[model samples]
Target chain A: MKKTKKVRQEELKKTIEDSPFITDEELAKRFGVSIQTIRLDRMEMSIPELRERIKSVATQEWNETVKALPIEEVIGEVVDLELDERAISILDIKPEHVFSRNNIARGHHLFAQANSLAVAVINDELALTARSSIQFSRQVKLGERVVAKAAVKGEDERGQTIVQVQSFVENEEVFSGTFHMYRSNQ
Target chain B: MKKTKKVRQEELKKTIEDSPFITDEELAKRFGVSIQTIRLDRMEMSIPELRERIKSVATQEWNETVKALPIEEVIGEVVDLELDERAISILDIKPEHVFSRNNIARGHHLFAQANSLAVAVINDELALTARSSIQFSRQVKLGERVVAKAAVKGEDERGQTIVQVQSFVENEEVFSGTFHMYRSNQ
Candidate 1:
């Protein structure tokens, strides 16, 4: 038997909420309804399209995982993060991130990428950096992608947890830092 | 005697370049022209208004002082910087920088402010961080203005320059860091 419109729309809402990246065509097939009906149902329900929905869900998930800070504050797009273990992020250098005179990437941008990844890898309610030792091994240019990796390196006698961060442009190391973090137990 | 239109416009451009924050009304008074005429001249020259002009000049000056990196890469607006000496920047956390559920400022934003400031204080064509020790003293809230100060602490025997950075929110210290930098003279 065909489902009623109200019941179908409710199921549609639940499906989209569960998998926000599902396309309209896929939804139409799943619901045994026309693409127009799916679009109409979405419009009536005030649900955005797949792209917007995916972005919203991704942002929310990122916020949840990043207990120490807001995800938007991260210098780069974090692709993976395992609390108290390892994390990875990627930064794409744009024209604005290069010196107009030299077309070279700024040193601080690399540091921001590494430092933020270091902070993000910690599993704590509040993680604070107490100290770091860092080095820039190479110069990065505009239009390059810098990948940053961060790993937790255990704690010290003073109860300070250490995180190591390294950034690379392609296969070459660009920057690295070791951050000592203070975590607040809640 | 009144100046020619061409000469007057040229003078106006020069004056604005010298003081980007000057108002159109001030320009009119100085040039003995109506505010409308000043606006027209600015329009013809494709010069933006006072606010845009100030932002442009400030960004350009900040870029020039930061030889090791691009100004756009800085996490905040760097208002002042002296090579191998001291630098200052301001970051105004926005709604997007906080978690939607809670309006707390992200930790990475604070780290970016301090880390970038540390790199900006170095006097070199190419500078990179080797290590750093950082601390977050307090939680920063949304819409807060973070002011970061960076000072050079001289170089070690191995030619690594040390920079110290402290970030404050309304005079309360929120974050602090020490950076070791490597400079390439060539």
Candidate 2:
């Protein structure tokens, strides 16, 4: 059965609202329409691209991070988030993040992104960073997008989940940290 | 022989500028004047109390920190800072540091205060946090002043200076961390 244009557009809005990370091509496939038609529908509805939606979601989580978009081409937009297994997030360094003289992003901002992601990966009602060992090999400048990859490396003797996160700029490694997260007992 | 009033006031301002942590009683004794006279001079010169000055100094280091002064009477303002030995700093959580629903301070702010102090205690031209292991024993609320004390715990096998920072809300321990700091050879 073919749906009317008005009904399809309404459903499109609802779908995007429910899953902000859906790409335009995927939406077009889902709606059984041409890619160009999906683009036009998005433009008419004033809905931003997939990238904008991901940034907005991150901003709601942490007010200060990711107001600055990826100024360059996104190599990949893969956010692999699996509870108690692995999680990933992207942060672009904006003017606010860098020093006025150096344009170098502050170390704490980098740490915060990794630390919060470590907590997010835990399968618990509440999770906190028990301890973390972090190292900054290279300085991240403004406008660089940092992709943080966190993997759970099994539990320790204390039953704390050990999460290791490594952040990279494009392909170059920028920062790495290991977080021992405390999870609430179910 | 007695110094002129103008000369004494000029020296008082310079003394406070050089050592911001000096007490009013110490200033009075040093200038050979009554404490009341010192107070009057401070009032006339529009110089704030020692507490205000410490907050202002902390604010300069990180713009978002310590603007919210300690609301209650300070138990101790002991910032026992010795380069390459130990250093201490205080941070008061304010509106920006807390959640609207629950006025609990965010975990990352606590980490920043401790991490920055860990970096500051090193006697190098440039030092950074290579790694850290931190724990939050208790939740810190808004308006709570966290006193972070960092002490040098010698060097690791990797030649990294190990600094341990313990933060307290009054007498109760709130957070503690051990940081491996990277120091530049000067």
Candidate 3:
């Protein structure tokens, strides 16, 4: 009887796959079962709860053309890294990595690329960025290669671990940034 | 004779406008002048000196794009502003401002937006971020509005002003951050 019910639920779900509004009541009625039963089946199938399902469909319809816009060039490459005194990877930046018009890389991109590399170095189940700050010196030009050397700065008063990163383009210090990533509950 | 030479210089500049690679020696020979004269013309036009100019052009062509792509809806709107003693701004998060399936705002956007607002509120002609640290309490969700409040925490040893910011969603504190931005010489 249990197997039979599972098969019925799967069939009903497929039938309503095209429906913008799939409700527990509708599925229950179609399968001649209580709404609770249909809800259990939905959960077992990993279907989002009603509110999330609604949001997903609405977001899809509202932003069909603009989902997951790809970023072409990731600014800095990881050449060295470290976490909590553990060396992980290192990053390098070349003159070809900077903006030509101003010779300064866009601040946010530099931060993001460096932060992403920092996150990548962490070997945790989940790591979330908490904060970051950066400083830029003189202009970095083409043909000059920069290195991003990082180290764990310190744990803050609130227990956030501060990571310091510096980028040197062809021996000239071009950029430096720091990031904080939160480690989830152990 | 002076008028003729001026017209010839204009023509040469126009030719190089399309192809900046036109060498000073080539321009001087073509215009019946010394290389020094062509170099002077280039300098007067505010073009980078030869070595720097080549580097600039090549860098622009190569680093054609190093953009900071915004991850969808990971930040909220500024709802309040206070620019005394410490620059501050309050922000609220909407449901769409979440990053992952768990409905938490990405940590980086939260800090970036708050830090940018604080720096802007400084009303200084030039300001650049220097360093920061932050911590997170809990995850934030969609449809739950958040409040981002900021203040200047203190100055670092290097004299950079550090600002503290916190974001609360649904009366529950979600994120808190500190930022440092440098005041430029007027």
Candidate 4:
């Protein structure tokens, strides 16, 4: 019985190595055990459930490009940031960054990227966006890597932080905006 | 010759209507003209080129619900609008109408929508945004359509118009924003 159990465990690990997406039923059948037993084994191994595994995969893909970077690298590369009382972020638009036939940068991406950069600069573990506003001054076009710059504008008595940011394509300024973020007390 | 041109015109219109994505080569071939000619026609109609057109379609789709209403209806929905000394615009957001995911409304959408509304309210033939500043206060979530109550904030002595606006998503106040719009003297 002990030899059989040991063999089953070895087979389970090998099965996992063969395909990461093994089902509980399949594992149970291979081990001559109940589905619940297979699940327990999975749990003991610190393997997430199906939904969690899928979510982790997606998160991994997303982090591959943007989220994996440290806050400092994100602030510097994605949004050229200038920190002070208020944070300022600048993003330069490139041809590949445009979403419109006119080659203009998409408004949402511009705002979100700038906001993300601003959030990174906050000296806190948890930062939340409270509000924002922006204006598109000129249409950005293809082949233009507009520089987006952000700066800290001010902070309120309640500790809410305000940041100003701008994006420029070519020599022309394309978009300018501002954001407010809140940090929870750790 | 006129009959031939009419046939070509019908074909071109059909291509544009049948598929929102009409390649320049296809259009040129149908019209028996150069790609440049098709481009010129598109420019004359204010239709952005391929990539821009694709982006416009997508963005329009996302904002379709809001844009479906007449401009007058938009004004009726929002309250407390004022023009500043420099013709800048301001608006207020009430908590009920903000997006659920980001408690605060998106900054670009706010600015672009406000700028468009400001243009509609203005006598100028063309209005361009130059700069802006925004601050967010609290989380304004789903079911809240921010009531943008605004006034003209300040005009730089350089003939720029700055508009200040406040927004409340439902009962919780969301954000306050200012926009700078430039109108051609024409």
Q: What is the TM-score of chain A alone in each candidate?
A: 0.64, 0.59, 0.48, 0.50
Candidate with top lDDT is 1
Tens digit of per-residue lDDT, candidate 3, span B53-119: 4344432232221121222211334333344233223344554445444566545555556656555
Give the alpha carbon lDDT tens digit for every residue of B10-70 in model 1.
9999988776656787789999999999999999999998545534543335544686676
- Each prediction's interface RMSD? 3.9, 7.2, 6.3, 6.6
* lDDT tens digits by residue: candidate 1, A72-100: 76789887677887777878899766656
Worst 10 residues of 3 chain B by lDDT: B65-74
A35-90, model 3: which lDDT tens digit per residue? 99887887788886543543444322321111111112223443333334422222
Q: In model 3, state the lDDT of residue A92.
A: 38
The parts of candidate 3 lying over 4 Å away from their true place are A1-107, A129-164, A174-186, B1-76, B82-103, B142-144, B152-162
Query: Which number leads on TM-score?
Result: 2
**Taking the tens digit of each residue's C-alpha lDDT, what string does model 2 give over B1-186?**
899999998999999888765668778888999999999999999988866765554422322221111212112243545667776678879887664445767677888788777766677656666767778888889988787878899999999999998987754689998888877662
The root-mean-square deviation over C-alpha atoms between each candidate and the true structure, in angstroms, is 17.0, 13.8, 24.2, 23.3
Q: What is the lDDT of candidate 1?
A: 0.75
Quality class of the docking in candidate 4, CAPRI style: incorrect
**Could you give the DockQ of candidate 2?**
0.19
DockQ of each: 0.23, 0.19, 0.14, 0.20
